[model samples]
Target: MTGIKAPSKRQLNNYLYDRRREKFGRAAIYLDELEKWIFDGTTIPDDENEVFVFSYHVIEAEEPSFRLALSTKKLLNIVCSTDILHIDATYKLIWQGFPVLVLGTTDKNRKFHPLYLGVSTNERQEDFQMILMALKKRFCLYLIT
Candidate 1:
């Protein structure tokens, strides 16, 4: 052993979530880090960091609805070939108060694979339409391939 005392569970929890809750309490700064990683590609593991941010839109409302997409070429190809998609939305009431919409499909062998995720403050039709439009525009190759 290095003679270093391990942090208590409470200490770890405070270090991770409590600090974040405190900082994010002021404003909607939650997506800033994600934006950096997505836009600048500034995170570890060159292989995994090669993420393409097809579209990221945020509405600056009192309660904002934002949409973010992260996907790779290989995943898009798989999605195109699968030709089937499952879209579902789940509300996370505790954090961010936004509903997350997940779009996914299964491979040839019927293995499920998530294609994209979109988060919106409300589960309105327009929000979903916008998300779906973005996906279609970005992955239009599916039509031809």
Candidate 2:
């Protein structure tokens, strides 16, 4: 009888995990490298190309502050078309121990539509300016008109 042994359960699981390693296998990649993927504004493509890190502003210093902002095409449309800006920072609930900044617009009905979710390593005026400037840089002409 010709015999070919099938892979064990553990071997199959290991094979699947190895295939998924590029995205989720943290053990194989450095934390800083992973942070770069999450924090840097690299054009990661998908079917809809919806979620991505669009703004990544790093202040060069002895201790750098990394600021990141994420948005979608739909959200940018909302941001450019709307005028009622509602920016708020909620600190109690921290995302990776950093306060999350919310940028959105409120309609006449007071319904909120979040356009950008930004996070900075430091809480300072410059941090606020950086995120606002990032947004302004992208939609300055439209916002002005």
Q: Give the top-scoring candidate (TM-score).
A: 2
lDDT of 1 by residue, 1-145 (tens): 5999999999999798877878766535566655565566323223432456556666656774566666655555556566688888876422356666777997678887787666666677887787678777866643333
What tens-digit string does per-residue lDDT give for candidate 2 at 1-145? 4598888999999988888886775444334764777755457444233777767766556775677887775576677778788877778746666789889998888888888888877778988888788777874422222
In candidate 2 the C-alpha lDDT for residue 53 amounts to 76
Residue 130 deviation, candidate 2, in Å?
1.0
What's the true lDDT of residue 28 in model 1? 51
Off by over 4 Å in 1: 1-49, 92-95, 140-145
Error of 1 at 3 (Å): 24
Q: Which residue pairs come into collision in candidate 2?
A: none
Identify the candidate with maximal lDDT.
Answer: 2
Per-residue lDDT, model 2, residue 91, is: 86
Where is model 2 poorest over a 10-residue stretch in terms of lDDT?
Answer: 40-49
